[model samples]
Target chain A: MIEVKHLTKKYGDLVAVNDLNFKVEKGHIWGLLGPNAAGKTTTMRILTGYLPATDGQATVADFDVFEQPNDVKKVIGYLPESVPLYPEMTVTEYLGFVADIKQIPKAKKREAIEKTIVTSGLRSVRGRLIKNISRGYRQRVGIAQALIHDPRILILDEPTTGLDPAQIIEIRELIKSLKGERTIILSTHILAEVTQTCDGAVIINDGFLMASGSLEELTASFAVKKAGVHIRLRSASAEASALFKNMAGVKDVRPQDGGFTIEWSPGADLRDDVTRLVVEKDMGLLEMRPLGMNIEDLYLKIISGGMPQ
Target chain B: MKNIWAVFKKETKCYFTSPVAYVVIFVFLILTGFFFHSLISWFNTQSMQMAQNPYYMQQININQMVYSPLFHNISIILLLVIPLLTMRLLAEEKKIKTDELLYTSPISVLQIILGKYLAALFVLFVMLALTGVYSLFTFAYGNPELPAILCGYLGLFLMGAAFMGVGLFFSSLTENQIVAAVLTFGSLLLFWILNWAAFSAGAFWKDTLNYLSFFQHFDDLTRGILDTSDLVYYASFAFFGLFLTHSVLQSRRWR
Candidate 1:
């Protein structure tokens, strides 16, 4: 539902977002993965029509961001990084005001506010002032305001930044529940948030798009060829290491305190070979397992420009 | 239009929810009341002297002595107080970052400006309406010219609106409320004394200073003259201020 083409935003000599290109498909949750100052917020602002792109184009829901900003704004709900809110207003009152500004019909405004309050799990604090609420509840109110209009696209900048562990989990669950219902583009530096809640991710660094794909595709495409195996053997000696290193597909073997670690090439299942070698050499094999790459490893590899395949 | 109304209602509600509106209105009414009481005492003394001496035939116009000065003092008070009403309009939003919500909304810049401008004008209208009690008192015991009183109020309202527009523009220029308030006060004071330069300057400079003086235009209205030029001046002054405010808001997108 969103397409950004060579988007560039410059402030004098500083480029906030440089030649960034990405597209988000409809009904998919895309996580914008980047560290602080990675141009994620700038890119989101341009997509939402909040800031003019210095040299590029973006469109949302088929409306050009520069040419038809009003139309684009109508279909996209944005929650800025700061969670802009009127502290003096109650949850219901604030949502009501947002609904009014969004031009929901007068007859349906009340219903819309109620639905958003419930959706964001803000019904309990509906009557309390926003300033008096907890940070988690405040974030929920921010989300509620964005959802009041039921826009097709939701752009959230760091939706779970200041929350505690449980609050973060609650927010992640809320966002995960929203998957497949709307096109969601959320930016976060937390690798787990992307893995837990998003179906796809766009990794960026220094205002450059490093990688973009589904979670599995990103991990698989950025996977390293070498795999490490940890083995505990009764007979941990030089002969054992030599025997393991001499086996087919085994690249290196290093002895440790209790056993040794073996490195091998990809697409080679050396578990049976190592098992038979250990049995034949009379090296009692206590344990042997293959280490797989997690999202954090994939993210680090992509950010460090070390993608193997 | 609906967007304007929504913003207007929200802004007006915000004014009442905070202490700024009540404090400004209360202080304004108290100051205007004091000025009205003193003016009425002076008028009473002048009338008493005239009643004692039958040979004194120069009649004093009650509108001139009472209502004219009353409106004039209120206008000055508004000059000092309108900034307080308008300082938080746009500046506070910028400080708190709520301008993101406003700019990202589908509403146009014109609607936001008009909504805020009208909300401030409505607060001033309510305060002006409260001052009407003084006029009712004059009608009970004295004969004041109704047309002259109406004209005085018209001038005060228009001048207040013009000042509010300028204050709103300054509010848009900064995120600091104190800076916005002080700048607005300074600008209004400069306009208040624009004609002061006429005494030291030559003909061309003197006429230019006098023509630019807001007080000069207000003087003719206080005397019950409904000059179209003065009306157009106030209207255009407000328009110019709002236009600049719109430009400032639009320029923010580029930044």
Candidate 2:
């Protein structure tokens, strides 16, 4: 639903977004993962037409963001990083105002607002003034405003930035449930969020697009130095460690957590072989597991001058 | 136009619902009342001979009341109140980062600026309406000229519109509302002081610069002369300010 080609935005000498290229397919949730000031917010702002690119082009839902801004705006909802709201307005009043600004059909506005209030779980406090609401509810109100128009694309910058863990989870679930209905491009520094919420992601750092692909593809692209699998033999001792290390698929073995962890060759399945070896040696098999790459390590590998493959 | 109206309604609602609007209204009423009373007292002290002249006392030269003393007085209040009304128009949006919401909406940039401009104009309208009570006082004691009252309000309305335009432009220039308010007030003060400097330079320069003065144009309106040139000037002044605001917003896309 969104295509950004060679997008570059420069504020005089400072390049906020540089030579960025990415496309968001319909019905997919894409995360823009980056550290603070890594150009994620700038990228989202440009996509939403809040700021224009110094060079290149972007289109949303088939409408050029610059040439047909109103058309593009009609289909996209953006929640900026700060969650801007009129504090004097009540939650419902604020949403109504947004709906009006977005020009949602007057007849549909009330129904859409009700849906947004319920969906964002804001019905309980809809009558309370925005300034009096808690941060979590205020954040929900922000989401509600974005959702009130039922746009086809939602661009959220750091949607879960300030929330506690539980609030974050609640919002994440809310976003996840919205997953196939519209295209979502949300930026965040949280690695686990990308793992749990986004199907595809673009990693950026220092105004550069570091990597972009599906979650598994991103992990696989960085899946160098095949990880080791830890195996424990309840009955076997030091002698069994060497035997397991010498196995055909085993490249290296080390003691960890009172057990042996053996690194196997890539693409090699050793679970069957390890089970057979245990049976032959009469060493009882305790646990056998393949180590997976965590998001933090992958994030570091993508950003911290690590290999860009 | 519908979008403009939508924005206008929202902005007006914001003014009424917020404490800022109430505070501005309360302060505005107090200041205007003080000025009105001072004008009447100043007239009272002008010697009973002049004050008792039925022509001077009965009609009360609305031109003097509205154009000369009171016009400038209201201009000073405009310096204060217009900024308060306009400081939040665009600056608050930028500060809260809600400009993103407005920018990304289907509304045009002109609609946003015009909507905000009208909202500020609405407050000025309310202030002008409240001043009617002062006019009623004159009508109670003497035969007031309805044409003078209408003309006086016309000039005040146009001048206030121009001030709103200036304040709106300042609001667009900064994300800090305080800075916007301060800068707008300072700019209006500079305008207020410009004619004095022009006059001190002597007649040739004065005649040339007088045409450029907002006060000169207002002075004619207060004297009850419906000079088309002065009317045209204030309208152009307001339009130019709106045009400047539109350009400022357009330039934002580049930044």
Candidate 3:
């Protein structure tokens, strides 16, 4: 588990991260969403003990990041944005080095390396020098090194920033597989990544918390002007409008192209009610698309200072 | 201790796996071989000429004629070569950003510094040991004072350690290897010529400059005149350089 309370970081006069707060339960994958220069990297560095925070407190696995950094370090694995590594070392050799410094006991070191190798899919290129590997493989090695120690919390800063479409899918699959074992916090500018992988999200812009919650909660936020779900029937019918309108929490309804856009009061999930109501009417439901369905719309809506008053 | 060992092992492995260790050791041995050949041949002729005069034969001192000059000449060679070994110690880490991995691991900064510094010292030890083959040849042909030659080697090691300390400091200050090398060479050259500036100073300042000069204390050990103060000087200078490196790394974190 991780909790950051009132965390602020400053580089002289520049406020990089300003008064941020969030929490992640054990076995949860949380996405940290932001644009460029949004203090994502700075925040990770502070949590990893690589850079000191200007103010506030962050704890990982119940240990304070500032007061007991070494204790914190022992339980956390960090992958920096650039994927820093020793090009001269082979994949297995690099993982071994990380294991040694992390103080993995002598007997368990080999087991840990083997487990991580299989987990990250690095067995095929274990002997190849890191500099000789492809960018995708190198990124895998970066993630491999972080997992060798098996810390309780893992922090990755833009792990898939520079990769092909196929490689991105491979890396994302690897991350999703490790979700239930530890608390994972990954930062990225890509919207689909959060919706596809994270259990929840903490969205920040200009170092301030704009909005944060589960996917459903954030999609139900006030940022969506006419907030709710839009559904399309198998066949066009006038009664389709009346069925959704009678449901509680339904505020407004409109027609868009071949579908009816249903607007609900803020913070209501009408998907279950709408789906059940459609079946009751013996109408074929062709589709249902929620407003701000993907974080792409929600991310843009809130980032543009469009948060409804 | 384990963390330091890990860093030491990694650094030493890096030195040998690349062409750096072989190239550095080869260049050092070849240069010292030429110096040893010329000094021994030169001493042979000088001794032959002095043998003809019964009174002049009393001045036949191989310690002064061969060992002293050889040790002094080796110091100059170290001044040029030590920077090559020390330049990449910290500079490369910062350049490739491996320091991030090193810092975020469960190791202290002191362990990282000590580990790297010890690797450089180990390389220096290797270079000095290879040159020891020269002293063996001298011992085989002529009876040079064993203690004096050994003392001279000790002086050379201490001087080289001091040089490495300065080199490591420069390496920590920059990410570019060339900048680190040039800065190490430039600042070390200044300290080497520091006593020359003493020639024109007032009495008190003259003594201070001479004492601050790296060569001043080294001169005593070359003659086999061992002193506690001289040993302290080199050891302390080496530690002081490493201390400066530690401060640079620590301050960067806070900033």
Worst 10-residue lDDT window, candidate 3 chain B = B134-143
TM-score of 3: 0.90
Which of candidates 1 and 2 is the stronger one according to lDDT? 1
Q: Write the per-residue lDDT of candidate 2 for residues A1-309, one digit (tens) a residue.
A: 889899998988999888998888999999999888889998888888888889989989999988888788889888889898888888988898899888888899889999999999997999999899999998898888888889889999899988999999999999998877899999999888999999999999888888898988887877655656777777658888888878887888888776787888778878788789888998877888777665568798767867453
Model 1 lDDT, residue A121, Cα? 96
Q: Give the whole-model CA lDDT for all candidates, comma-separated.
A: 0.90, 0.84, 0.89
RMSD (Cα, Å) for all candidates, in order, is 2.6, 3.1, 4.3
Ranking of models by lDDT: 1, 3, 2
- Per DockQ, the best of the predicted structures is 1
**Which tens-of-lDDT digit does each residue in A151-259 have in candidate 3?**
8899999989899999899999999988888899999988888998899888988888877788877776634354688788775467788767788999988877777
Q: Considering only N, C-alpha and C atoms within 3 Å, which residue pairs clash in candidate 3? A: none
lDDT for B207 in candidate 3 is 95
TM-score of each model, in listed order: 0.94, 0.91, 0.90
| Deviation (Å) of B84 in candidate 2 | 2.4
Model 2, span B102-127: residue lDDT tens: 88888889999988899889988987
Q: What's the TM for chain B in candidate 3?
A: 0.98
